[model samples]
Target chain A: MTPHLSITDQPVDVASALAAVQTDAAGAVNAFIGTVRNQSGGRPVRRLHYESYDSMALTQLGHVVAQAYEKWPMLQEVAVVHRKGTLELGDVAVVVAVATPHRAESFAACQFIIDTLKQVVTIWKREEYEDGTEWVAAHP
Target chain B: MSLKVALFGITRDIVGTSVIELPAPAPATVGELLAEMRKQYPALGELRSCAVAVNNEYATHDHPLRTTDEIALIPPVAGG
Candidate 1:
């Protein structure tokens, strides 16, 4: 099967992804990108490190697509990319793309994937500050 | 008796492992389990915004824990 979900540490290529989408068939394409921020809890961030239990993490990512398909029958395809390892501020951390016949369904599915990913997916990030480093626990 | 608890992200890195086993009579709730972990692993005490999931779902602090249940510690996500 063509895997619709992926988890990686490398940078994301949004244009290539957009180029691959079958725009002819997909009337709408909605994509969401997550990037590292400059601060967390008002503290300045130098960099961030992300880690996960690879196998289990992939399993949970697959579940997100399954849930999306179940909830939005019209959804055609989904592409998910998650980065791991050390990342500096302003780096891309995660990307979610959904294609459907309509814009509304694509938007809904993309939002659900990202919002729920924060709450469900087993990925963790640590914020490295100038003074020290701390792991972030929730999406803010 | 002991139960295995999987810590991830900051928790694992701080304690330095993916799985941790607690002494018998594991805490009844997820929150209590976290408290116990803090007492055992000093680094866990530094986390104030970590999230807990029972199996794969984002569970509440009141979520019950069992010897056989799968528990995961999810730190913040920065994926885009």
Candidate 2:
């Protein structure tokens, strides 16, 4: 089976991520893509620099996937990919995909994975504007 | 014992190093280590929040620390 969680500096490939969770038994698939927006909190974003405590981030991601599986037993598989390092506006920052036997479960599990990952994963991003930069927390 | 703690994100920038070694009290728990870190690096206290990880798992402040444990300071996460 492919890894259920990953943290990398390379661009997140949505297709490959979807393929990882796809299975013959799966009747539904859902995905969530997080992109670097042009603006945040009314500030114009020039770019974003992401960083991670890679080992810990991967461990936390596994916990998130495990929780999703426990909550939705019908889920066939889940894949979470997060990009680290600098990214320009509009670049994909992260992707979470889930495969299940039904659409509702797939969507719910996908959302749960991303939400929990954001809360527990050890990743951080520095948002840079034209004037300055600041490290943003997952929660306000 | 001297314990080396890995730093990330803003913590790395504030301490100006990726790793820092602290002379921990004997039989130190994560709480004790955090106190020492705060005393040494006041900037860490200014963050909205932070978490401690021992051996790649999220650790409670009461989690015991050994000389061999891999500890890291995890500032607030922002990943999607």
Candidate 3:
């Protein structure tokens, strides 16, 4: 099955993401969903603004998926979606799901996708507070 | 030959533009290009970390750049 990897400006479709990784041969599926929170660095966050380098972001996401396939050869299907633009508190920021013959590999692949994506994907987030705004993790 | 560098996130905020053009006779390599960028835009040096990508792939400092290559500044990523 073709992996569902995308960066979109629209709201993330969790159901579609899960469906993308569904296969008859799969015994277990694992998913990781990331959402915006209300606070950061002890300050109240009004919202979050996400931006992407577009082409390069997609390329990096593809690389992450490719690495996942190499690490988990038993993986049946995978789906990863990240949202861009302003996001309200409690809104989903990203979703990653994986399907495999066993539960262990499903969980491992899903976790690996999200973790590696956070480190490599060319996407950024800026936290907006009632007082001001600052980019998340833009500095050490 | 001039080179156009794409910027995003905080780098765009600091540079005040989405794209910056280097003067004629661009730097020979990625390392030289980074040094030239820091000199031209001092605020870029303050970032905790910054990476370079050439043609959509992460590039090392020694990666030689061609005139037709696509270049971008990648600030510390926070995506989940």
Candidate 4:
């Protein structure tokens, strides 16, 4: 089967992705979703804005999937989605899902995807507060 | 000659865009070029860790730069 990896700016539908990637041969599906929060440190955030170099970000996401496939030859499918634009508290910003014939491969691949995405992809987030504003580093 | 550079994250936001081409001095080190860039773009100096990359590969401060090559100052990688 084809590798079902994707990086999207639209609101990701977990249901749809789960259906599309489910296979009889694959027994486990691991997933992760990053959500917008209402606060950062001591500041109370009113809203959050996310932006990215969309085409380049997707290309980097694809590279992460390729690396996962290489490391876990049993991996069946993968998908990584990221939201771009204004987001509020509790809104999902990123979703990474992986499926494999066993639980360990799916778990490891999903973690790898999120870690790689955070490390390499070109995405930015701006936090807005009532008193001020700031841009949070997507990583350390 | 023109030396193109890739800007990311806060650098892109403060500059209001990315992928800029600026004039380069003749045969300068990456450190020298960055000093010139910081002068032209004062906002970049505010960043704590602006990494230097030559031709898409990361390099140290003293790496020599060529007029015909691409140079980019990338802020720290923050994605997760």
Candidate 5:
């Protein structure tokens, strides 16, 4: 099954990611959603601004999903959706869903996809506090 | 030769531009390109980690660069 990967400036649709990975033959489906929180590093964050290198981010997402497929060959479907733009607190930032023949495979693949995507994807986020804004993890 | 380097995140903020054109006779490799960029824009040198991507793929310092290659400065990523 082909993996569904996307980068958008709008709110991430969690249902669409889940639906994309729905397959009758799969017995287990797992999903991981990342959201913007109210605080960071002891500072109260008002919002977040995400940006991406568009094409490169998608390409890296593809590579991450491919690695998961290679590790879990039984994976029947996969979907990764990441949002880039100004997002308020509690907004969905990213979603990773995977369907496999067993629960173990689904869970493992889902975790791997999100973790790898964080490290490799060409995307960045800036934290907006009451006083100032700083790019998250940009320096170290 | 002219080379264009795309910037994103902090690099964009530091350079104050989305894309920048390298001077004529561009650097020959990723390492040289980064060095040249840091010299031109000293603020870029302060980043704890910076990566170079060539044609949408992470490239090593020794990787040769061409004028037509899609070069980008990738700062530390924080994507979820």
Candidate 6:
């Protein structure tokens, strides 16, 4: 099995993530890259600081991969890489890649991996603006 | 007995520490630990929702916590 899950403080490498999920049997590969937007909810963001419970996040990431496989049995491989720590605008923060025998399944699996990861993983991001900083999705 | 709970994100900021040591009774459930945490740091109550992870997996409120269990406070996640 390919290395399908990771959490890093460095920049997320989209190419490597796609490469990891590439296989000879796969006829289609889909990749999703999430970058730091310049603004959020009308406030200009200076940067983003991401944090995670490393071990727990990794374990949850593995579960996400397993879920993708369970949902799309045709998926040949999957890679999910989430970047932590400070990131400037336009920096790649996450990459999800999936390969399968067909395009539709690969795309669906990739989407499911990212969507499930955001819900279940123990990772958070703090949006820093010129005036102040706040943890995203923290308040009720 | 004392149990050390790992804190992250807003919980860490509210508690002002990455790891917190709480005086928990033996055979404590995750709900009990969270109650103690909220009592100590009431600011945690402001969160919309949070999950408790025991030994790297999401734990139910009634899940029993051992002294050696790796406990983590998972706040509302926003990672993509």
Give the DockQ ranking, best first: 6, 3, 5, 2, 4, 1
| Model 4 misplaced stretches (Cα beyond 4 Å) | A5-7, A138-140, B16-19, B24-35, B52-73
TM-score of 6: 0.97
- Against the hidden reference, what TM-scores do the models get? 0.73, 0.95, 0.98, 0.79, 0.98, 0.97
**Mind giving the per-residue lDDT tens digits that candidate 3 earns over A1-140?**
67898989899999999999999999998999999999987899999999998899889989889999999999999999999999999999999999999999998999999999999899999999998999888776
Say which candidate scores most in lDDT.
Answer: 5
Model 1: docking quality category = acceptable
lDDT, residue B19, candidate 2: 87
Which window of ten consecutive residues has the lowest lDDT sum in model 6 chain B?
B19-28
Residue range B1-80, candidate 1, lDDT tens digits: 46787877667777788888778787888898878877877666665566667766667889888777777776655443
Segments of candidate 3 deviating more than 4 angstroms: none
Instruction: Give interface RMSD, every candidate, in order.
Output: 3.7, 2.1, 0.8, 3.6, 0.8, 0.7
**What lDDT score goes with residue A116 in model 3?**
91
DockQ of each: 0.34, 0.67, 0.88, 0.37, 0.88, 0.89
Judged by DockQ cut-offs, the docking class of candidate 4 is: acceptable
What is the Å distance of residue B36 in model 6 from its true position? 1.3
TM-scores for chain B, listed for all candidates: 0.84, 0.91, 0.94, 0.80, 0.96, 0.92
Pick the DockQ winner. 6
Residue A75 accuracy (lDDT) in model 6: 85
Candidate 2 accuracy as TM-score: 0.95
What is the interface root-mean-square deviation of candidate 4?
A: 3.6
Rank order (by lDDT, best first): 5, 3, 6, 2, 1, 4
- Tens digits of per-residue lDDT for model 1 on A44-112? 899888886666677778887788889998777778888888888788888788888999998899999
- Model 1, runs deviating above 4 Å: A1-3, A19-23, A138-140, B1-5, B21-39, B42-80
Give the worst 10-residue stretch by lDDT in candidate 3 chain A.
A131-140
Candidate 4 residue lDDT tens string, B1-80? 55777776777776676887766444377787678778878877877667676755557888987777666666755554
In candidate 5, the residue pairs with backbone N, CA or C atoms under 3 Å apart (3 or more residues apart, or in different chains) clash, namely none
lDDT of 6 at A68: 79
